[model samples]
Structure formats: structure tokens, C-alpha cells
Target: MQRRYVVVIVALLIVAGAGGLLVTGVCRVRELAARMNCMSHLKQWAFALHNSADTFPVERNEKQVSAFLSGTIPNADLPPEQRLSWLVSALPYMEQSHVFLQIDSTRGAGDPRNQRPIENRFEHLICPSSGEYDRSSRTWKSAGPLTHYVGVAGVGADAAALPLGHPKAGVFGYDRRTAIPNDIPDGTSNTLLLIETSQNPGHWAFGGPATVRGLVPESAPYLGDDRPFGGWHGNHTVWSSKKSHYCIVALADGAVHSLTNATAPEILEALATVAGKESLPANW
Candidate 1:
């Protein structure tokens, strides 16, 4: 009788251990799927950028083609704050032309006429790994469904003030930089285009934090905390296993790289510029 009881107890322990392992394996698979889905989203945006460069009219209204692909749609007479995001301009190429047409170009991105389009929840602009922000109520989300992704405003803006204009070495700026293909002194494959961040304005239809962000020192990724795009500033545990060990980014060449949290700050800077003329480390 004693031997039988021992055998039964051992079998139960084995079953419990196996069940735990199965659950863990299932969870990891889901995380990976979500991560890959997020990568696909960034890739689509990259294609949109490329398509816009080659197709947008050279003279849309007044400014030259460079001006249209310019990061902001600011009228010469308007303040930078009132400018529309380049994201709006790229909508047509991204298969969201219907939404793009809804926007009134004569008005600012925040105008009442643009509200209907601003509320659109673009699934391709979101990452499954950013589920913590997905929980926010529609009304509370204000601008629209949150875009966990944001443009890399360049590595130099890693200063105290947010430089939204000139000298933004990245691919974008406030109507100051051009998105023409191969325009950068640094090759497309060598430059950073976008990054996964939570330290943004959470909106996608406007400029500034809504569309771009400087890779400032405070915005380290995966370190956890609201240190910019590094990790969730709010509750990190919003979803099961959401803390990622690496930060994901898309290069101008439309390639994705999973940068580990321990990646040196200098390495990131090297990748952020278009004309910095910096060389990356071999081990990086």
C-alpha cells in the first residue's frame, strides 16, 4: 500500500511539471507571434515612405516635390504647430487613400473637418506588443487608437529640449527635412527610420510627438520605466510577458533590427543619423 501511494504521488508531480512547461511554451509562442506582427507593421510603413518618394507630384500646389515629402505640411504662412503630419501625406501610398482624401488640406491637422479621419484606428500602425496602451478607452485615447510606433527624429536631439525643426539629423523634421530616396549622405541601410516607443504623444495624425521623437538619452529602450521609448512608463505588467528584452527599429532601407537593451548608447547614435558620417562597431 505504501509503495502504491508513493507511485501515485510521483506520477501526479510529473503531470504537474509537464503542464507548467506546456503553458510556458504556449505563452512564449504567442509573444513571438506578436513581435513578428509588429515588425510587419513597421515594414509596411517603410514601403509607404519609399512609394511616396517615387510617386508624389513634384509640384503639389506650390512647394516643390521636396516640400511635399517634407515631414510637415505647414503652409508658409502658418505656425509649425498648425502643420499636418507627413503621415497624412503618405496615406495614399499605404492603401489608406480613402482616409487621406477625408482630410481637408486647406485646414490644419487638428481642424474639426479632420476629426473623423483622425479617429481612424489604423491597425497597420500599431504593434501587438503595445497592448498596455490598447486598453485605453476610445474617448480617453482622444486622438485615435494609439500608435506604439514613432519616427526617429535623429540621435542628436538627445538633449534637454525637443528640437522639432532644423538640424534633426534623422529622416524627418518639422517641414525642414526631405524624404527623397537616397538623399542622405549615409546609405539607406545605415540610417534609422522608426522605432517602437511609448514616450510619444500617442496620436498619429499630427506632428511633434504624435509623429516623431528624438532618440534622447532619457528614451532608452527595454530598461523599463517611462524613460522615453525604453519601456512602459505606466504598468509594465498590463499584459502577460510584455517586457521585451530588446527594442525593435526599422532602418531606412526597410530592414528591421532587434537591438538589445544593453546596446551601447553610442551604437544607437551611429544608426540614427543620415549624414553623421559615423561608422558602426564590428561587434554591433
Candidate 2:
């Protein structure tokens, strides 16, 4: 009887161990699926951006091209509030043409005509890893719908402070039209375009709040804090995996890469510029 009892106990222990391992495997698979899904979302945006550029090529005369999609035209006597963003301009290519048509580009994102589309959530823009949608936070309050991704505005101490229409090294400048292939002197493959961030203003319709203006080091802790560049993955602050600190970024070439927090800051800065003339390091 004693031998039988011991045998039964051993079998139960083995079964429990196997069950734990199975659960762990399943969880890891799910996490990987979410990451892939996020990558797919970035890919879609890249495709739409390239298509938009093709449809509306930039004029040879830089002055003639609309700078940031701000609702107001440069040198025009329009109020600052009349600004719009690249996301709004690229709507037609994203298959959101109906929403795009509803927006009056001449008016600001706050215009009532843009309310419906601005508030509507785009599932593709949300990261599955971001968890349940909670709008109670300050980032989401009155910010319209939330977005997991944002554009790399430029490389500077404060690119966001620059006046609208000023030249930005990054692809999405203020009040600017879509960047063409020729604009990216660093090669489309090297230029950073968009990034997955949790610190967005949650307003996909506007551009001012959807851009990362400066080069925040990848090693910077993902404090999951409220900072604009902070991570939003649960209690973890950075947008990285448990095994490593990393984030997903899309290049102008339409390729998505998993960048680790250990990535060289100089490389990150160089990637944010269009004509900085900087070369990627050998290791990169």
C-alpha cells in the first residue's frame, strides 16, 4: 500500500510540472503573436505612407509643397489652431478615404467636422500588448482615440518646439506633405520613420502630439510613466520584452526592425534624420 501511494504521488507531481510548462509555452506563443500583429500594423502604415507619397508627389520647389499638414497654409493669415497632421493627409491611402473626405483640411483637428473620424478607433493602430483600453488617464482624456504608434519628427533637443513649416530632418515635419524617395538622403532603409510608443496624446487625427521630437536613448528606462516617450506596457515602463528591452520601429524603406535598448544612441539619432549625412555604425 505504501509503494502504491508513493507511485501515485510521483505521477501527480510529474503531471503538475508538465502542466506548468505547457502554460508557459502557450503564454510565450501568445506574446509572440501579439508582437507579430504589432509589426503587421506598422507594415500597413508604411505601405499607406509610401502610396500617399506616390499619389501626391512633392513639388520640385520645396516652398510649393505644403509643410506639415497643419490646416493653415504657410505665410497665410490663418490662426495657429488651424493645423492638421500627416496622419490625416494619409487617410485616403489607409482606406479611410471616407473619413478623410469628411475632414476639412482648411480647419483644425478640433473642428467639428473631424469629430467623428477623430474619435473613431482604428484597431490596426492599437497594440494587442497594450491591454484593455482605458481612457481615464490624462493621455487619453479629451485626446480622441488612442494610438500605440507615433512618427519620428526629427533629431534635436526639442524638434517639437520648432515653428510649423520649419525643415525637419525626419519624414513627418510640421505642416509638410508626404516625403518622397529623393528626400531621404540617408537611404530609406536607414531613416527611422515611425515608432511604437505608449506616450501618445491618443489623438490619431492630429500630428503635433503624435511625433517624437528628440532622440531618447533606447537604454532609457521604460518607466511606464506618463512621460511622452515612456513605455506603456503594463507596469513596465519601456516598450520591450521581459528577456530584453526593445522596441519596434519602421524605417522609411517600409521595413520594421526590433531595436534593443542597448542600441547605440548615435545610431538612433542618425536614423531620425533625412539628410544628416551620418553613416550607420558597422555593428548596426
- Give the CA lDDT, 0 to 100, for residue 162 in model 1: 29
Model 1 misplaced stretches (Cα beyond 4 Å): 1-5, 57-68, 76-81, 132-143, 156-168, 179-182, 218-225, 230-244
lDDT of 1 by residue, 1-284 (tens): 99999999999999998997777677667677777777788888887877777675354345555312555676775554566777888889888889898998778877899888878877777666666435345223334556777777676553112232233367776655544443466667877787887555466777666777667654454234455554522222332555545567888887987665677776777777666778787777
Instruction: Give Cα distance to truth, residue 185, candidate 1, Å.
Output: 1.9
lDDT of 1 at 68: 21
CA lDDT, every model vs. true structure: 0.66, 0.62
Where's the lowest-lDDT run of ten residues in candidate 2?
66-75
Clashes of 2: 14
TM-score of each: 0.79, 0.76
What is the Cα-based lDDT of residue 141 in candidate 1? 33
